[model samples]
Target chain A: MPSRISMRFVIDSSVMQAAGRAHPVDKRPKRCRGFLDVVYGCNHRVVVTDEIETEWRQHSSRVAVMWQRRMRTHRKIWRPPPDAIEPLTDAIAGVESNRREQKLMQEDLFLLEAALAADKIVTSLDKEVHGLFRNAAKEIPKLRRVIWVDLDEPDEDGAKWVSGGVSLDPERMLGSSHE
Target chain B: MASRSGRGNHDSKQQDAGVTRITVAGFKSIREEQSIDVAPLTILAGANSSGKSSMMQPLLLLKQTLEASYDPAPLLLDGPNVRFTKAGQFLSRSQKGEPGGEFRIAVQLGTNDRVEICLGKTPKAGFGVRRLTSTMFGNTYELTPEMDHDAVRGQLPLAAKLADGSFPEEVREQCVWRVRQDRCFLGVEATHGDGDHWATFSYLPAEALSHELRNLIHLPALRGNRGRDYPVTAVGESFLGGFDAYVASVIAQWQTEEAGGDLTCMNGDLELLGLTWKAVTRRVSDAHMEIQVARLPRSTVGGEDDLVNVADVGIGVSQVLPVLVALQVARPGQLVYIEQPEIHLHPRAQVALAKVFSRAAKRGVRVVVETHSSLLLLAVQALVAEGKLSPDLVKLHWFTRSETDGTTRIDTADLDEAGAFGEWPEDFGDVEWTAENAYLNAAEKALRRGMKDAK
Candidate 1:
């Protein structure tokens, strides 16, 4: 039998921002190479809608500020893949028909729609808009939900560390309240 | 009005305002009334889906109406389906509570004497009935709902009688040809009367109508490298003939430049033809199938034959050839609708394609191309600046979507003689790179410096 394929992670804006700040040498958020590793390691596809691109563009000035700060650190910022835009756009359109009640803006709806179409996980740290994706996942049969949350806490050795939720064992979450 | 000089050429004759103005309404994105003055050349500029295609509908409708028989389905497909109940219900209703769907095209034609052909809803029939009416020298005739069964029989005697009595017989005959939308009816009209009397209206032949319709070619945006053998159909024979000639010339030019000898043979092999050519060919054998290409000559010394397959050559060349072939094969006086002609082409090739359009336009072809390349637009402006095309002949419209209005507006620009214009849109080219990312980079650098000082 073929192994079951399931999307395993969702990376949000916070994770992207954290990844940008985490570079010890550079202050600029480079392309999320580490995050990309996580995506590849889990055998999952990442999706972005035109709306998400637009939102990121709106904060481009800030991104530039972060980028300049990191120039001396010789750090690189994450850049979206240009050629993959058309396929991503098509994916967004495919989901538009399925999500009728979600009065999401054309771009927002498209992102959710794209996630549904590609059967991929979404990574965004937006608590407010998590419901939109969750609703889409419920309505769309192939879609699954993933969320990114702050996992910075002290371990048994009294050392504070940051980790991904997908990486944390469920048994660990059950015993620890700090997470 | 006859010209004083008897020496008249085809170009000069055509320059005599065959089509004057076109008016469109309730068609696709054009919900409000809009009119375009048909000059020697008219450029339509708009962002994607901003009713630029709607402007072409009047011309398409005219072609359909004049031909003896035509299926309106293809033309209708270009527009939103008003009859689709689900979609229709979703659309906002007009003041009258009707389905708010409507479309009409009115055209003015002739020189020294003018005639107007209007097709759409009349006040009596609402918007469902398609009416064709003609007005000349202040007289009007209702030529639709086709008066009686005889009109449907296609005799058009009522049309002839109306034309002869109200207007000059010649004017009436011209009006008749202008109104008929299919070829067979025009043929019937030609045979029914004394052939000489109908000769003035002879310009409205089936062949001419077909040619005009075929000119409205829409090239798809998708790009592919492998050459698919498109058949030499009647619709594209003239264009194919032109393509063959163009390719032959390119091969000849390459041979002269490379071989330093007179060109005598026409062969498919680019190497023998002396052109910098790359191709992929597939061969079948018992062991396995193979694909390959001949290596490009290095300097003057030729030794080992370099071989590669079609896939080895860059996609840009193969993808671009199809478009060039399609354009070359297109008949003159037709509208070629190309979406982003600059895709996968180098800057040099993009400019070359722009020149091709200039040449095609000079040959009496009308081209409507959509492009995001400033270089292509600049090339067109150069043609206008050099007087190859009149300033009035070139029209540029810009499409801008306003968030406040929730609508797209197409604004026309005036390019001065030097091909320079005022105020390009802030977001014209890669706005994200120039405005947002540039600022982000600066901030990032500043933050990094602060961190260094703290360390």
Candidate 2:
């Protein structure tokens, strides 16, 4: 049974682009597709920032586009204003020092900002950035609250978390909710 | 013209002159109150029998009532714009077929003023106004029948301000009239027009509202008949009937004017729509005139003398003529409600009509269109994306009927800067999507089968 508590999640463009591919051919895309289905069926909202929306429009397939359009109709798509984005981006830049990690952070930091703006939940396929952000969470208190999920990995299960109402589990979360 | 005092001076800002929003409740297929914001270019789209037309019917009812020669009923059930025989024909009914008690209609002006009128069936089996209320410039005024129903009492929050000569002079004069005269049926005053002038001012808001309704122009789905020769009728002070009926006479009137400016613009629009013909009116007789269209010369050497009667051309041209003419002659602050502007034209021509509607909205004519053409709507979206029309000036309302109760509900959406709707219903353009997908899937399947057979 699906949990009654609805969650808001920021779905990275990587997952959306793969979910849009032909479903019968690949195991990775099929998992991504199944995660989105579970997310929608459980009444969880999909959050997008301006940059995230632009990326989805450019790279996502027709399947993802149709899903997003339906989400808009159901009022289940949240577009949080950029009130906290610019400052948060600046903060992320200041916390990271390595040149290579800095470049990756700059590219994926928007997902964190959007997640912070909505619920502190993000479902992404980018495992490299997920590892980097988990390492950086030690320096930033706000980043500690982010709960990252990677459906591409064999061990990670997205459908259970979504159907269970995305409860605060320390194993899936970077750190504790309290600073 | 007596004392015309207390006439309210609304804000004359170009952006704030037309109707801004409308609300309807307890009307046919609309059991609950539904309100929609009116933009410069408003589109109403939905499935058939979803109450898309019912939402705008109240405005047409008021227009026809104000245009009636003699005041017979509070609302003219059967008229030129909309036709119905009895009050029960339009009143709301329960799921079990029980009729509702009363119906309410409200119009909100761009100036932030709102007027709401309620009507019910009277003892004589005729529709009568039960209550009229208006909120103007932060002041509220109401009128209703007295205890014995013999006299109508006025309720004004700023009665002292009205008596102190602070209100506009024209509104004061407009409000002061005999209640029983029925000249201003919207006022519903029963105070026998004695020396008590303040009692009459309560109806001032209704008078102003009626004036606004009278100024509205409507073009029904079915326009005037196509005829080779049109009789020239005298232009009335206001719209006496359907605006479509006055299209030819107005064209003739423009021909007699100094510049014939609107006629030239109308011809240009006709050409833009790919009609490839210019309309000209000839005075065949004193009271009769004929409209002829000449095809554009294919070459410079070709003469312009080859003219044919409008009736002889394609029916789409004559049907769209009235819509073009109405847009050309309309003033900036006026509202022109048209149903199905793309009736018989080709898809390309329907797309061209979007440009015409966008230009008219740019010129400050509030245009409300109810249509089923996805081509026309897509063209409007393109115009917004290209920055030719502001997304802020456009609003789209989708009406959906509840499958369970058969009542209507409206879901409104605004276009983003990219011309994409913020919230679009699933089935809005799903038929086209479904057809395209089906065709693609069929083609792919056939190709796979052919390759296997060759192997």
Candidate 3:
């Protein structure tokens, strides 16, 4: 069947690297690749900022490059320029009082900027940063609507979410935690 | 059998005769020897001026030389396939301002048969063959010009075999080499062992090599534009070198023969491409005809006009018709090199062209495509993953030029079962991403400025 809906997504470089490291029996890499394949096959676009592309260049495998080529050919790789992350970085740092959590958000700030630039959806393999951003969403208005998904874990049901065309379920948004 | 000119042995299993690899050196951007392994579906891709055409031009040069009306002075510098009036025009130039010292071309047919030739400037005669080496019938031979250039000296290991009595004694003196006027021989008599008797046996391999080179079909990038009138040609006569000249005639021939088999197939492919029109040819006279397109009968509704001259419709249909005809009429074991088959096509139609190429390759025609369309490449990969085509049949060569030396190098990649290239060249097909980022940046700035005005 064709895709139900086309959504723009910002996938973390770690997930891309995992997808490139495919295995015959390992479900982790399979799910990683499967999520991406579903995302591509369903016509969803991938958002890549300069930071994300840099990470991809550093870590992604040949398979990921091939997938990226397909995405580019289909016009499904949505790359927004590097936004002024300083504003968002200051906002997150102000909201999250803990230094470690502030550092976590700093490292993954590009995801928020990229997602906010387009559809506000993200797929990542980083669990701690995913949780810290969700918790900080209460104080940060811009990060509230960001949808954080981890394909490596079952809590977010990454397989089911991606298989379902990545619909923006209210429960998956960071703002849902505050509500 | 398909009546299309240059098509022979329609069976896919007969693809054993397809050209396997081509090597070009000291020609244009290719200063070093660059080899591309030709597959059933070979794709040559790179940025503009990265030497993609240089790889294929060698074959075209050979084809035009063989097809010329008169004997060429070794190599035909100007011809229908590729045009160059002088040797220095095409010879690779160095940054230091000197021309390449040597120019060589080698083509491998099948697994074992190979032909490699070197060209040199012949004083007043543009360029001529300096040395010829061929491996045919499981034996290798080298031929070079004698001192005065009146005769060619051949080193045939088969001669040694003949002397050792491994073969029949009748073959000993049967080796003969003669130059015929009607045939485009290299214009030199070849002799082995300082004797005339050992000459005749060498001509078979050389003739077979020439036949293969002559059989190469090149459809240049620029095809004929849409026209109301197309000329009719003699029945079953082929337009081998003139790709556009053959479209109308081939369509006319197919419409009259084999129950319109090729015509029906072409219409089906056009429909699949969302073209909505069927190509129809009408003979206006014995020597002239017009090719037109009519809306598919099923697609017409509400008393709409069904027929229109091909020139009246969108140029995309006209531009793609020749490509469709070329692929449909080509037979297995035949090499059809098309440049930019996706030109003037929508992204969807360009993707559909991949299916056309895949089908042609599966049927045994060696399809060599030079394109800058990533959509076409993606479509071919999708076909492999869908099981419509095997990965083994596809070969991709990415041409990249050195920043410092300006010489071209090829990076070859293979497709796996999942349709992913085994090795993806760096920064290839990334233009879309760059454009996307640029557009997004502009959009974001516009949004921020609009917000400032609202405040």
Top DockQ: which candidate number?
2
DockQ of 1: 0.03
| Best candidate (score: lDDT) | 2
How much is B251 displaced in model 3, in angstroms? Answer: 1.2
lDDT of each: 0.42, 0.73, 0.72
Classified by CAPRI criteria, candidate 3 counts as incorrect
Q: Tell me the tens digit of each residue's lDDT in model 1 across B114-226.
A: 33333334465433334444444444444444444345234344445533555465554444333344321122132124556533232221243345443345544454443
In the order shown, the candidates' DockQ scores are 0.03, 0.08, 0.05
What lDDT does model 2 reach? 0.73
- For model 3 the local lDDT of residue B109 reads 83
> For model 1, what is the alpha-carbon lDDT of residue A94?
48
TM-score per prediction, in order, is 0.46, 0.69, 0.68
Per-residue lDDT of model 2, residues B1-455, tens digit only: 01212122212354477688989998899989999888778999888888888988887887787788877567877888889888787788999988887888898887779988888865654568766677887877666533223233335534435443544555543443223323224443322233554443343566666766776778888886657777777664355667866777878877776776767777888888887547878888987787877655131245466777788878888889889987766666578888988998889889999998887787777789998898888788889879998887788998899899999989998887767775455344455544433544455566667778888
Which ranges in model 1 have alpha carbons more than 4 Å from their true place? A1-179, B1-22, B37-43, B57-99, B107-129, B133-142, B146-211, B223-228, B232-313, B329-332, B382-392, B401-408, B422-455
- Local distance difference test, candidate 3: 0.72
Which candidate do you rate higher for lDDT, 1 or 2?
2
